[model samples]
Target: MTLIDPRNRYPRPPFKTQPQDFPGLSANMGPEPDYGLDSYQSGERLKGLVALITGGDSGIGRAVAIAYAKEGADIALAYLDAEEKDAQNIASSIEAIGRRCLLLPGDIRKKTVCVDWIDETVKKLGGIDILVNNAAFQHPRKDLLDIEDEEWRCHFDTNIHGMFYLTKAALPHLKPGASIINTSSVNTRTPMSILIPYSMTKAAIANFTVSLAGSLVEKGIRVNSVLPGPIWTPFIATGMPAEQHESFGSQAPMGRPGQPAELAGAYVYLADPNNTYTTGALLPVHGGMPQL
Candidate 1:
């Protein structure tokens, strides 16, 4: 399908058609074809499972939601109110795959909202088999002293605090074989000069994953984290400066940014019941970011 921006004066190309080939086109492109349309195919790995994912409206969350649907699991999607349209679209896509999708719009930053979201997911889906704590926000700061206390608090509230709230609320419903997958960042390892608060939260998420996994092991619940290096998502355009967005993900060893589709497989594997031995593990999907 051809996705043209309404504001653009020129015609947009079809999905999966390379941008390089259409030099004359000057439109604000839609989602990369690989993430949105081309690369996602159902695999039924999580048949009969139920999953609740925060930020399942767009980007990595949307990719994971579609993947989970394809894997034969029902999804309860939670996102901020601003993303309701995107979340509904993803719900429609999940339904097209013969899976049920429930959309819950709220801010994960509020403890009460987090509790309610988890409660609603359990009520709608019966019980949670996979809990994905993936909602996050970041504000870039160039100077360390320029960072305000409010921004620091907001970072913790959105990234780490929300995860804690949702996890605590869902723990009661998550059964012996349930899995919790948190999204960390490559910036946690290779700190970015501009995103101190964001990177700190990601590092804390890594630690939280480890501690949660250890605590849940006796109960048979698994917790693991995925550290994504540089994936091209709406966050890049909305969170970073225009110059950074123009060349986002280009610095990776792969010489290109990752599409959301590429990370969905990892989430499926971690969430699958068949693989029960792994927990408290950190999987780095950073286009070959060094390990040492």
Candidate 2:
């Protein structure tokens, strides 16, 4: 067995300044975010289950989708039409692993899109055993007044509202022993001044996760959130200023950013039926970043 030091496992500071437009594609990212295409090994932990993951085209969502598929779960990926290339690539990877993959491309900000995707996943992939509310929007503004009204609404609409819509839509189809995982951020606790809107939504997501967990426990549904710190993904490439890209994950004590591959195991553990007692938990996958 080989032991790897977590601190230096992934790329560190001085990242290339390759910024893209909003909703950036991982394909264009320098040192492209790793979505477990090669490193993750399957344990067949979630065999024969079905999962619906928003933003499954790239970054953290892509990692989770691939990990779930490797664990023997059929996947339904929901992403934007603009991210079709990334989505298609992930779908192919999942299919290559001998798992079924369904692609639903649309904006999650619309309630109709959220509901339709759930229905389609049920109709096509059997049923939803895991619902991952991972799609989100973020834009940094140094001044609160500089955050436009539309931008503020966009943050909440894409983050919390979409999660609410998707969860409500997926609940009925999710039977006992189902898992609902939301992608929250460490900013919920250590809010970034410039990321006011995005950080606020993350805080709300954490609360929603805990509250939903209590409400669903009696039904045998597990609800939880994964709070990630500064992970190297397209979020940084597009959301922050080009100058900030160089030191992206340098703030973390680990001195490096986490790759999506690093967080895949956490989702797998939460979705495993054998881990029945672990619910309403906020699993922190930050690299030595203290959440509280």
Candidate 3:
């Protein structure tokens, strides 16, 4: 078995395909993304806590959910029907770790789904202490004019709007020590032309994290956002045309695509209840990708 080194530069060979080729299934990606089953260990830092993770079917979301389970937290996973296969596997893995996994499958674009997911989480897992707003939609376009009005609007609905809906619904159940982690991106600082809509939402997420952190301080709720660089996920495999996949992470300073497992640490650290003083922080897991 080849031991994967987190520090080495990774080269993703060229691949070309039609857009949205893989949809939500990471398992079917040419080089299956690692969800960190072998690389991570349990510290039980989140014992007795309950979390609701959006897009928990695969990639970083899956990694975070599994890590949280290892830390002794029960999970409520939100995902799309297209991701059901991977979602089921994630659920089973969480259960195998001796924690309950509640699978809530639906589009976050719908306000009702967001509300219902939180309600179901509280009902099943007792209460939510961690809310990971990790679900997002990104479609790369070569030109600004190529983006359609409907697609642009959908990005906001799925990315930022859903976060708002869920956070509002979860507030009542959240205690003073709860932590909310939103998935921002390196593009928040350096916008990529291909991902204009996605970048816009991420910047908004970072802004929301800071603004919300200040507002929630009185309630002792901490809010933060994570900025991920080029990490190998289903997004790289299928979001854009196949030709773009060859050098996906080559642009990062580290010259490699980070595995989903790399971001797991930041997610857990930000959610650490004992680390109470940390809030409104933008934790970057970007393989040395310069923020500026």
Candidate 4:
């Protein structure tokens, strides 16, 4: 029998830059990420539902938005204003799939914006049944000095606090049998020194999911979190240092980074109507990464 080597998966020394900024574009990656168009058999698991997803413009969020649409759900996608191009791409794809798309562009870090967007989504979509708190911001700094006060605050603001703002505003409108899926990270399990603030925020997210799940489940609104490994998204190429980019996800046990499309199924599974018993769980889609 022949043996296979794990390191061969998407060999590093990556080819991507032009947009050397945070939340990189998928179009520029070496092997363009699979957004499930060529895969993901759909059975309309979420038929006739409406979802509000933050960070639905790119990466995992983008994949989830498209998958939800294919599963027969109308979507209200909230993304940063700067990600207009990526957001438009998602919107077009969703619309093409015969699902309605309401694109809301704003910063979730602002409480008023998050609250206002939820109102707009409810008004346009008629009601909210699924909420994907997926938008996040992270900056890796090797030294403490490199992490400024504002950067630290931004991490909590965008990661955890923004989640609170959006979740609180959307809570009352969420009907029975609803689902709330929060996008967390593997960093919560194994904290990265450079990403201390990001790790703290992720830990808080897990706690929030479990605690909130308890309070909401009785009302028929379930809550869960997805703990993902190093997914090959623009979030890395743009936020990480140039030299580090090539070796971005090589540290995972699988010896490679995951693609955004790979994580879509977990979100879909959690949102499925049949998943009435699954809540307060942190589902990890990290290729061989230890969640505990």
- For every candidate in turn, the CA RMSD to the true structure comes to 7.1, 0.9, 2.3, 3.0
What TM-scores do the predictions have?
0.88, 0.98, 0.95, 0.93
Per-residue lDDT of model 1, residues 31-143, tens digit only: 44244434566668899999998888777888888898888999999888877667767788788879999998988889999999888888888888999999988878889
Candidate 3: Cα lDDT at 88: 89
**Ranking under TM-score, best-scoring first?**
2, 3, 4, 1
Which residue pairs does candidate 3 place in steric collision? 16-242, 16-243, 17-242
Q: Candidate 2 at 52: error in angstroms? A: 0.4
Judge candidate 4 at residue 288 and give its lDDT.
88
Q: Which stretches in model 2 have alpha-carbon errors above 4 Å?
A: none
Prediction-by-prediction clash tally? 0, 0, 3, 2
Clashes of 1: 0
By lDDT, is 1 or 3 better?
Answer: 3
Candidates 2 and 4 compared: the better one by lDDT is 2
Candidate 4 regions with alpha-carbon error over 4 angstroms? 1-19
**TM-score, prediction 2:** 0.98
List the global CA lDDT of all models: 0.80, 0.92, 0.88, 0.86
Clash pairs for candidate 1: none
Better of 2 and 3 by TM-score: 2
